[model samples]
Target: MRIQNAFRLALVGTLGVGAGLLILSAVASLSTILTYVGVALFLALGLEPAISGLERRGLPRWAAILLVVLGVAALVAALLLTVIPIIVEQVGELIALIPVIIAQLNRVDWIEWLQEQFPLLKIDEISEQAAAALTDFFTNPDKLSELLGGVWQVALAIGSGVFAVIVVAVLTVYFTASLDAMKRATYQLVPASRRARFADLTEQITQSVGRYVIGQVSLAAVNGVLSFAFLSIIQAPFPAVLAFVAFLFSLVPLVGTLTGSIIIVLACLIPGVGSPLTALVAAIYYLVYMQIEAYVLAPRIMSRAVRVPGALVVVAALAGGALLGILGALVAIPTAAAILLIIKQVVIPRQNER
Candidate 1:
């Protein structure tokens, strides 16, 4: 019987792989569809509490949903309004300073000192070629003109991204409004005698995910704000932009914080802000903040939530990021959490039953 089961499993796996490959080759695609659905489901689950709270205050379900979504939209618009102009101005300033940075770097004592030891090393050769090419192009340009053409393509990309955002928002609103109906339909798939048990477990899982996601978001926001404040105090260029990037990247699990810090530090070098001393200070800040998040904030906010182990978190983050870049990394934590939940719910329960 066990051998028969193994053969059946192998056959199912082989067929599933073949179908997946065929879909990858032939279908328009299910990737974006699935991702959008997942995002809508997550947004609905997150907003469920707010919906309940407003309902308790005697608001109609539709009215409560609309009010919450509108509030969220307004807050998001306000944040973009405040943050966008600062980032644009900072970015322009940084780009304008690039030539000055290169010039200053060429005159640095270290470069001259290094050249003395390595006389054959033509330090300025590559820069001179780039400068000559740029001057030639600008004085009488072609490729430079082509570069300007690319700006229009960027605008189109932005438009597409905005469209995607709108679609996601619409889906989220629909999902949130029909959450109870969706749950009912989902539970309908289970046997009648098991529906209550399934519902209870589903509620537990949703609550767990909600708590974990909310806590992680709060921690990321705090980290961003603190980082921006620290960078501003140290007179780092593009502090707000870097902090915003950090916040966005923070949705990815363990490695994101470190990746963001590295990017910020590299960008800091562009505008003459990141000195050795400042770099050391930044390192210390990261260490302190990471310690606090891991030991203090995370424990307080997410302890009763995920219960995913430290080692597993590290492994999942690394493996996921390696395979799927940022999306993989972001999905890894929840995937690991769900697996842990399933092990407890199924394996341990059955073991104890026996």
Candidate 2:
């Protein structure tokens, strides 16, 4: 009887492990779908504040949502219509100038200086070899075919991206429309005694997320506008395209602005587009701008949005980026804030009681 009981226990343990593995496998398989759903939900929460604001001003909920959505759609359409073609043209120009840029690099003062410093290093030889390799790659049929295959892959990826955008957009609208209902349903799952508290915390969390999204976007817009103005003034290459790039990168947390600034400065150094003095001036502007952004703009804008500590923000952004790339980074700060709120309201109190 003892042996039979032990055997039964082992069988159950094995089954439990198997079930757990199967569940994990299922989750892994559904990861992409899950990511889309998560992004949609995040965006819905972000739009909630605007919808609520409109609702407060005597608009019906449906009308408020419709207006906000239409406004956003219009803005997106306008940007695409005006900016995309210019960006594409600028990109083509950049690609066409690559050989000229490479040839110019061989004559750069820095290359000569580096060669002077390192007597054994043959900078010209390396540059020539690189140029030759590039020329050979372009001329070779097999290499050209490989390049064509890569282009096909890029085309497929773009198609997939468009499908993803559509999916996320539709999901966002659905989630936004039913968000209140969803919340109520969620509250119902909690015990009556705890439901009110849960609902309150949920509201707070969602509001924080919404405000953060708005604040972040506002910052990005500021950066984009300033970047465009500055780049134009400096006669930098593709001002509009570079500004758009800045705006997109600024949407990410922590390292976004710095990365954008670096890219812009590098672009300023590109042969035919900008000179070394132009790049230096652009770099200086960005350095000062970053300081202003850090000390002034971010604090003022983000103060009401989320009250995360600087250290925690860095850690959360890094961890989130590692886990889910940009989306993870975007959500990480709010997730941390939500966790902190729960810990303060629930965990600490429980500990005190104990």
Candidate 3:
């Protein structure tokens, strides 16, 4: 290598590595801040449409804001009242069976099959293994609360997380009511010559995110209702609880729906509602629903506004789950869709023009 060229190459490599590490450290520290920002943005988007409707109803601006906020508060209050009792009843039923369920696991046919497949596996003592698994599963305070504990604990955890949500709601009201002012402020930040392009990108992102929120809410409602219907048909206990789980998890992208299905399947197995055939029947049911959702349901419900290919949906969901657990996975698809919109706006137009 020529000495000067080698020196330049090494300088560029060092700079790149330095930049990467800086970004990583900044992200680690700033993640909490970014989370609040994303929450505020999503809330603003969802509330903006409702706020607009109120404005068009000849409501004064402050009155419109108050109406929208109060309306949301009423919904939240209703959920707490209506859903908690059902969840608690079902949860008591579930935990009451835990010791019995643990015993039942040792008696499953699959355990013997596993022993035969690896005879020496019992060198670890099969009973001890089962006991240890149960012990560990119930030992973690957070995990156990989510699973084996009373419904009240779960509800308390949910209530604890409500602070961020309340803040987001307050921010959303201010942002939505002043959207036009926000827009003008945003434009002022850009050089006048570049404002048009910036405005277009901003508008595109707003529409995409808004569409995503509305679509997911509608889809979740449908999933919740369908799940309740199926659970009720099978005479499964806790139909309402299962349906509520479906509704909440539905906010998650692809994986959330899958999880809700598996949960219902497990709950049914608890009651022996469809015991031997439960998993198979549940799988087949979702397979049919998945087809309907992919082809007919999403297009009509989501307005083809965010075109997430099936393969990409799975990839994004898995990646999001690996990185940040379930909530990340839920938000990942729409985030991907927004990024794709930006890329298409720049790349596709340029390609066609070329």
> Which window of 10 residues has the lowest lDDT sum in candidate 1?
267-276
* TM-score for predicted model 2 compared with the true structure: 0.89
lDDT of 3 by residue, 1-354 (tens): 999999999999999999999999999899766776666777677666676677898988778877887887898799779879878987897778778777777677776787888887773476788889889888878887777557887788898678767766667767777776888898999998989988998877776667777788888889888987887776666788888988888787776777777886776666333374755676678778867876788779876547777788789888978887755675677778877887888778889998
Could you tell me how far off, in angstroms, the CA of residue 303 lies in candidate 1 after the best superposition? 1.8
lDDT for each residue of candidate 1 in 50-73, tens digit (9 for 90 to 100): 777899999999999989889888
Overall lDDT per candidate, in order of appearance? 0.80, 0.94, 0.77
Taking the tens digit of each residue's C-alpha lDDT, what string does model 2 give over 268-320?
88887789999999999999999999999999999999999999999999999
TM-score to native of every candidate shown: 0.80, 0.89, 0.73
Which has the greatest TM-score?
2
Per-model root-mean-square deviation over C-alphas:
5.2, 2.9, 6.0
Residue pairs clashing in model 2 are none
In model 1, pairs of residues that clash are none
What number of clashing residue pairs does each candidate have, in the order they appear?
0, 0, 1
Candidate 3 ranges with C-alpha deviation above 4 Å: 1-24, 56-61, 99-174, 177-179, 271-274, 278-280, 308-331, 343-354
Best by lDDT: 2
